[model samples]
Target: MQHDQPRPRRANKSGIRQVLFNSLSFLLIFLPIVLSGFLICRRYGNVQWVFIWLFICSAVFYGAWEPRYIFLLISSILFNYFVAIQLARSKSKPLLAFGIVVNLGSLAYFKYLNFILQTWSSVLGADFQPVAITLPLGISFITFIQIAFLVDVFRNSSDDLGFPKYALFVAYFPHLIAGPIIHHKEVMSQFTNARLAAISANDVVGGIALILCGLFKKVIIADTMASYSTPAFHLAGQLQPISFFDAWGALLAFTFQIYFDFSGYSDIAIGLSRLFGVRLPVNFDSPYKATSIIDFWRRWHITLSRFLRDYLYVPLGGNRHGVLRRYSNLMIVMLLGGLWHGASWMFVIWGGLHGTYLIINHAFHFLKRKIGEQSLSVLIASRLFSLLVFPAVMLSWVFFRSESWQGAKTMLRGMLGYNGILLPERYQAVLGSLNDWVMSTLHMHTGDLVTFGSFRAVLWMILVTAFVFLLPNSQQLLSEFDRSSGLAEDGHLRSRMLAFRPTAISAVVAAGVGIVVLAAIYAGVPSEFIYFQF
Candidate 1:
């Protein structure tokens, strides 16, 4: 894994304007220029020109970071496209294998070669000089996407083939950097549609609304959570002992932080695609509300989950053999899933924990079936069990967030109260006689106990948790929302008063929210999407 940087780190490359979907440069300047040019191309009845221009624009968007890396992306796209066509004509297994190898080989060299060399050096007790390797942006995501397409070709599922469409699919700016992992099947059909060339007004309004909502999620909610989580996790990474309350505080903060961060990015990607009269797959669906680990995987990073299930899990005798085999397959998929996030032992452990949780969840599900109908107590117990799963998930997240295993261990120890559960000295007197009595009854001695964290941090944790549980998610808020019809009847407003549909009043509200978010972003540095690292 890469070294953990200090908190509030500048996430973007040094540049005038990058292709961040949320940035003002992207929203105000870049998008308009590209859209106008593309629409004008369409207006002139030049469909082929439209595709060519789009590929150029998308390449420019991606290359804005580092022009050198654009060659890597283009090479991957061309090699895969050429090899896929060969696999189609010759139906050669070795050819398909070669293609997969080249794709993964490039990914390993760029992303994991140093990691491997460092590990081997430690094992061999010798210094293995590592070569300088700078990871190209979105290598992991783009590689996985191409691999999926190649696998589909080998299986004779991808019958359609075109270089222009394929190039655009690979470099499409919306999902390029971070993605919902668009499938060859999902996007290729859309690209061939002639209607997409012409811009629609409804698409414009709906797209902007989605973009603003995503901005709200990132700037207003996720960045705020980062303030609390970063320090706590940083302390853990330093191997410092934290109090029980502080540990939970940090874990909870991250649980929400990652949710909003990546999901916020997903929202923006989907919104940007909509702006171009295309649709990307939904990646998140209020995963925190899920009742089981199995359910949580279904909702969280839905695209990745789909890819793993279809490509890895099913191919490995998924549930077809026996219960034991099914459990093993789950472990394999999740272990690789964690490792896919980064080259770290902690990620492997995190995946292992979730795999165990899934096994237990499935076991309980079996028992519930055997037990049949129960009384109110059993139902309440089941509900509590579901709620308890969140904390267990949070436990796994310590490994996920920490810089190393040692850091994870430090945080876990604090969470288990190896560090004292101490109230602030200032608040000790406020607890008065009851504090002393409780401490004595519990066979605990209270000295000048250190406080876990600031009252404000705790307060933010409470407020964030409340919002997670109480409010509807972005998907639910915009469900069945039609641009032409204003708002669908099924798109009922449950929690908030502001309408999701574009209107004179709703536009004003969205504009106000956008202004506030833009102000917050300009006031501080723009944060990078967390998933970009993967």
Candidate 2:
């Protein structure tokens, strides 16, 4: 698209944007009232009252996006609950299959219908217009949650789980949109704890701390990085030549942009849930620190990986089958996983690339085992090879971020040096006496190579890398506050110095962070979380 080209209008009344966690509508209005109601209900009334109030507020929170779609969400919950009831009554395979089919069918209709229609029209030269389907907010997450519940009920016959609690499970605002994909078992059990109805001082302080950290990540880091990443990808999408440094800058910038954005949203969600004495599952660990694609999946969007493993992979015979079958299964699962992110071929390619990387990773491991070598060189080789993990994952992200094939190709070409190199002008000063020789011999271009807001974009990548690689994450800092919830009980602790205790110092720090994040939010328009569309 040329700069002056008029934009094409979207289909009529496509969908209403949901309120963002960082948005004023959510922060100033929705959160305080809901938090108060939960505390009030829990204090004076029974646990059931607490659950009921949370569910009602959750419904309002979701319905506020598009009032008409609330029925669709409720209908999904009611329908799934009915199926679970039937499955509990009789352990019928056909009934379970029907329930799964229905859930998937609804998802396909709402999420994939437009993609399919558009593809078919392009292929078959059809003139038919696509249907104006409004994808209800969090439909993907909601559908998967219900499907998982139905499966569990079929397997274990959970007839007495009750409707209100189940409704709370589905409608809960925190994990409802872009989830850590909480299991019904984990959430329901927590809510039932007689002790959970009353709020703990640690939970309150720590939850606020986590929300503050999340706001900082979103408002300060991720949204700021978006200034560079968005335009870079847009330029590539337009098929403009991206210089080498420019492309890699865009790639690394987006990798962290998405990392912080989604993780921030997860932190906020977990914190919000924690406020009500519930803990949503951990969605992100330090995934960029992963040594391989396998480790990456383990750390990133973990609950989704668990879902695929339990519901999809295990059923597909998992590793019980021979190697070839296992590899095929792995590809199928990832391909579907990519498609699950969004109804696009770019996503499919992203999934496929990860699947390939996983296959190669497994192959390398298998070959190493066959060697049976305890030599120092083998150990060093293994460790050095681990370095490829970051670059490999970063490469995959280019495809994930770019919507069109040409755009992704353009970025990839630059990353691989098909595009000419552009050194930062400051680099010329560092080169000193060797500068003239290098300029002539190496053909390096030097100028203003990066731009992000008012600063050079590449400079921020340094801070982003250090923060992801060196600093303790928000959850880790708040580890002492709630040890039993989520991974705090078992996950790695890289540092103790950053522990967020409920001391005066910690209180001051949290307050300072909260003030900074609020100011940032007040200063700019908060961007929607990257994963919300998925």
Candidate 3:
């Protein structure tokens, strides 16, 4: 019933500011000004002056999109700050509850109201007029950060860092828009007298290297992968059936694209924070290498996982109550997590798929506990299980990538070979030459197996696969060189090779990579960070 459809083009908006971290403008102009200002303030004025200037600069950066929205951001911060103050002083449950409602209400009003209206209209077959609403950039991220702050206030777990420091925490610009979703305790404590006055050589070197590495990931790897994945997913939206090979190729391409894109954003955010002499938490750690869904969550968008686990999963009674409660909690957390990403049914389905995967994973673990295995055997089994887990992860991405249920269904059907398969026309003659007997015995003609338009996609797959399974991640690469910062140093074999050092060769390599990234940004079309939508 479906035919090929044209894919909707993505709007090329980079961020709230015209300057993207991946863009040359941020590198050549905006960053230098901000960094210089910070340094100058540190030298010439008081710490309060530095904070005030940083806040002003951050406001300009955010307001670059629409000056009016900056007021929303400011209002949200002040309102939440006041509530937190009241909550801290009175320990009133009512105030905490009101604060939670206001934050969520603001988010829902901006992000979901239109979607809700559309859904209701369709369900009731009623004509409904929906009002235009532009979602405020980074509302989802900041709201969650403030909510965490409020909860900490309620628990009496956070220090009373005054309004100036707290405002800086919320609108720091680096982790403000897209985030590793910083914590109050870690970030607030670091904004001390000593940290404000200093910018170390290690931080500068390490930070620049991270920024270049991140830019390479975004401009080179993620963007290249997007070209392939976009059209393939577009085929689904057009209701066009794809071949088995095309479906998998596209799915795999997007898998890498999103990983590299968002992880790249996290890397840049952390690196920029470091340039300011503050360290944000590491977010990604080669999540695709994970063997289980549980392991995958721990490694991918790690701070989001931490937030969901600490805020939602734990509050839902966690594993303490019963097996049923625990499973239900996992489902709830993942479903909300999916909804948190976007206002769409497909996202919900994507979340549901992961929830199911987690349940099955836990069931398998329970069975294994009952039938205990040797350590060596378990390790081997886990490796094999990881192979199985990856394809399942890819399958869930079908929903994530598709715009609608029908689109997802079309892609899934193609992946299962429900749609007839054919090799590319270029390969027909060579495949036709295969011995008839060999073809008959195998029940597959050469024509039946498709070639992805070119071998380029396959090559990309191989390269990214090697990187995921073989190469050390950015965090691991920088681990040895910078001991002062809390970068992750998980003892994986591949991770041990590239210990960052302030050597001539290291400087040359970093410079070369930086030059290449800058050239690419100028040469290639500017694209938005994938997570900016979320």
Candidate 4:
């Protein structure tokens, strides 16, 4: 979803400007100019000038997509800034409420109006053609950031650093489109004169390391996975049958595809922000490795989870209430969190499914505590993670990725083996009657997900699985270099040998990786990250 433009660019067929982190134009043209301009501004004037320059550059980056929406963005910033200062001065709850309403109102107008229309049409049994409402890119993220700032100000948590700095925080291109959903507390302190003017060698090296690694993830691995996954999903959408092997293969491929895609985007964001000596909150943390739904939420999209906890859950009375209320609150948060990603019932269902998983996970913990020993936590964690959680997560992804409920149902049925297993034609000769039974009873089809052979799909799964489970993440690799790798104290690196060392050999290895990434962008087709639509 971060596949957007920088500066003024010729419009694509969709009328969206054609530049993104994946584009060579961004890599070769835009980033260099912004970085140079930032340094020049920092050198020539005060920190305000630095922020102003960055703010303007950020506007250009965003406006490159649709120049009209830049006005909406600025209007939102100015309105929020004015109200935040007023709320801080007056301590008026009404002022804060008004600010939040207007912001949410803007979001609903652009993002949810079409959704509302369709829902009404269905409910009323009246055909209503949806209105054309072009969503402002990153409206969801922008609204959240501004609302957080306003509330934080009202709470007297973070200082109002004036408009210029605040605008830069909102418009900062790296995390602007898709985000870690940064807190005012996480970034505002780094806006000071001393921090912006200075640069660290480690930041440079680590940042470059992160950006290159992210590029590889997006352009090569994620895109490759997409090729295996998309057609299968499309088949399901078309109401066609999929074999168990094909469905599972496609599901697993998508699981890796989204992970790598978002992980790539997050790394690029953190790394790019790091280049400016500004640290963003960590977004992804090898979520597929998480042992429980609770643990998965803790690891994946961390800042968004934190935001939900702090802003929504706490306000709704959190776990302080009785068990029933706590469970209720959990469902509400998860459902809204799902809707927050996109205005779709599919996302809502995905969120609800996760909510149920969390409730079950929590109930297991509660019941176990009453009946058994605390010592079983780690052992149960491993058992549950492998046997239950991972498979459940993969299952939920069907709804998450599918365009229609029918598609999701088809995929789910396939995974459960109702749609049957795909066996190779060679098995017909080996098994005779059994092969006949396999052909008819198992519903082996010629045009199923893995029609050619299961070999390629199976191999892809192995390679991606190894990359996911074996290797240290970009954050871990850069932890030694960039202090804001956000690796928790308890977190462990898979291998110290994988650590980034500032040596000649490491540089050479990095160069090799970079060249591979460059080759990938040139040779491979460009794809937008999944979250970009949200």
Candidate 5:
């Protein structure tokens, strides 16, 4: 017996033409963004120009290649769009089932096939070399968003999708690169009624602010740390008696680097969206200050977590089944999530580690609740334990960050006090050259371990971290700086003792402008967003 399939809907000629127009418009819009970079490059002759070119090229290439994968992209979009329409029309269980299968199946193909093949090859000891598959840029995130839309559609929880709005939702340039992973229900309504006009001053200011912030994080903070971390890790096998200090320095630098790099991207995404008068949800909320692993997950890469919970975890029974089943579901979701990051065993292991940690955390909570003696001290102690646990996670990042399995293994072994035995003459020349390069790079004196520059970088990072943690939330700031009073209240004791002043606003604005100018001058070429790997 043959199964009846949902008939493919006839092409909407206007919709197809509009898609083409939208695609072309994106290319045209990017031209000015690129021209600005070219101008900067010509004027400064700096590495910053190289980054701008890289970003511009990546964006343009992806949009151009969308046609090559247009069948898949459009098919996925149509599948969800139609399903949502049908669900909104009536609660149809079959429509929902079909939508879920298609969404999940497409995601698995693009995201997991390589990882699956590799795992099977390793386990079976077979000489299986897979062909290199070109992934659509941002497919990882876009796919997740699509899946969530489908699930919501199935549940009759979403509105009907409009073709133009849906296309823009997926292809919107700012969040398109490294996403806050928007949902259809969240953004589609705005696009439908979008004001098509020249950019406003507020948008211009906000977009510039976001762009500068992203540049500062990627170029000044992340890239500088990468220079030190990359070389140190590369020479891990050669270091003798363990350069523990250097290792710690490199690792810590990388830790902060990834944070700023990712959080900065999210900030830029949100800020840019604001320019369009659409508010994208905040993705990072000082995640480092999170007191528990669960809290950290909620704050860090929050959109991804929301996607997993809504699309993957909940569908697989979540915690609704029994405890054992819930634990199993958590493990499965995390393992898949890890593999989603990359087609590497290291990512799988990373996911599994997080899954295990979460499971244990859940179990502990269960036990504590049963005993009914959970105290503030115990909570504080648990938070401390979680902080200590971060080093292990950081070490796992070596694997995540490495280019190859062998490189990661070598680094790991080096960290564990393993160095291949060799005659003094064998590695002497190589070691000497590496040492000279490092010494010169840092301008190190005879006894000074760190140069003044490195010290200053560290100090700057500390200050940034302090600001991130101590600064009031946006809501709080807005409340304090209420303009109706003709004087903004400063939330400091000294300021309270004195009084508010109109000059305070001008001073703040002047300081902000000065910082932006300084940051732009110091900013290097644009660094690639870290999530681009997935």
Candidate 6:
């Protein structure tokens, strides 16, 4: 219906013209990486750059496809902007209710229907497979943001939004793919009166640094860990008598790999937004260092946690209700949160486990408060004990990450000390060599080389794990550095000078070159961002 509206027409152009212009724009911005990749491929005959280019092209295509989808994106922008405008102008309860229902309803349909259908079909054995609905790119994030905007409008928390500002908010390309999901209250005011030419050097430099850090985490750490983790998990069922060390090693590798991978993407997204003069929220803060599950959630995916609190937890009676109701709301929020990640039963189980952990944590806190046993020592001990409970939470990630229910069961069995008694004969040589290597490495016994790979993989995993837990959080580093000198005043000359210094410039240049080189090296591979599946 929105598409049918008569719109001002733009002159048509040849497809080639469109492609060339878009391609050139992308290449210019990404040129440093592109050129480096080309040089590397030419000298070494490695094809990494080819894959990177291909991936870039694929992303471009995804954005460019059915150009009508761009209109759909624009329509969403207009709808929200108009709703905010109307709500600001009038205090009509009906108008406010309509805005809430429409915005949230659209989000639910597009983002959750497939998940709901698949889940229901599994449980009910009903022949109710819905028509294939290809989710538009970034719909989940964009819709949630708009819903937030509408709520803010109704609450009179903000005034009516203008069109261009709202358009940019929804369609900002950097946070478009995955997100540190923006809120209208946070972004709209900045955009409406923005001086388009007022580019801050500090913002640009910081953005570049964040993007490079994210790229390094993804390409070097996450992908490398994934290479081995994938196979170990895939063959988990056949891995009878799974050496205890090997299973743990594989699990640890994956745990670190995913953390780096997702956090890296968030960093890049935030950095990219900064480049456009927007400050996105920090999404991670060395979550692995958290001494308890509650602390870990607080540190990890901070924005999502805030969203759950404001939109779901508070509305569902949060702590205002009695302890029992509060517990129920926590469980409901987490279960839905798990379902939000994917349509799979594993995610549901994962959510349930987290919910259970949170509920128990609340109970502990309640008891501590009731007894008035608020000693500093007791608080510290509680936190330390929570650290111990963290592993149990991490272990559940096995189910969350596994490919199938059987795979999860096999991994769990191995974890519980199940030695495979009926392994295939063909696996004996591989198993024997790996077992020997594991034994020799630990000074136990020589068994199998196949196990050697797992050992080596685990060694790498430990190194990475140490880094994750040991590294200072970005916020902490910034705070300490600021205290030594003074805070970088917003848009200040000193900040800009520091950003454009030779050392900083050189570092960015080097990063750009490196990205190009890596892109070239993997040019033949068509790797997509892992989160795209969700």
Residue clash pairs of candidate 3:
3-239, 3-240, 4-240, 5-238
Winner on TM-score between 4 and 6 is 4
The TM-scores, one per candidate, come to 0.90, 0.92, 0.92, 0.91, 0.70, 0.75
After TM-score superposition, the amount by which residue 303's alpha carbon in candidate 1 deviates from its true location, in angstroms, is: 0.4
Question: Residue by residue across 1-534, what tens digits does model 2's lDDT show?
Answer: 111111111112213223568766678888999988877877788778877998898898788768888888889889988888888889999999999999999999988887777777777877657678766777888888888899888779343578998998999988877887877887787776476645688787767888888888987899877777777787898898888878988888888888999889888988887787777788888888888789999999999999998999989998898999889989999999988988778888889999998888887788778875576776777787689999888899887888688888899898877888877657777789999899878778765564432344556778788999998777677666667645553244555766667889977888898888777767654364677645
lDDT per residue for candidate 4 within 347-415, as digits (tens), equals 788899999988888887787677674566756664765578788988888878887778888888888
What TM value does model 6 have?
0.75
Q: Native-vs-model 2 lDDT?
A: 0.79
Q: Looking at model 4, report the run of 10 residues with the lowest lDDT sum.
A: 1-10
Candidate 1 lDDT by residue in tens digits, 72-159:
8888888999999888788888887898899889978877786678778778877767677766777788999998898898888874
lDDT against the true structure, each candidate:
0.76, 0.79, 0.78, 0.79, 0.57, 0.60
Candidate 2 or 1, higher TM-score: 2
Candidate number that wins on lDDT, 1 or 5: 1
Which parts of model 5 are misplaced by more than 4 Å?
1-61, 64-72, 86-95, 192-207, 235-242, 373-380, 404-406, 416-526
Give the TM-score (vs. native) of candidate 2.
0.92
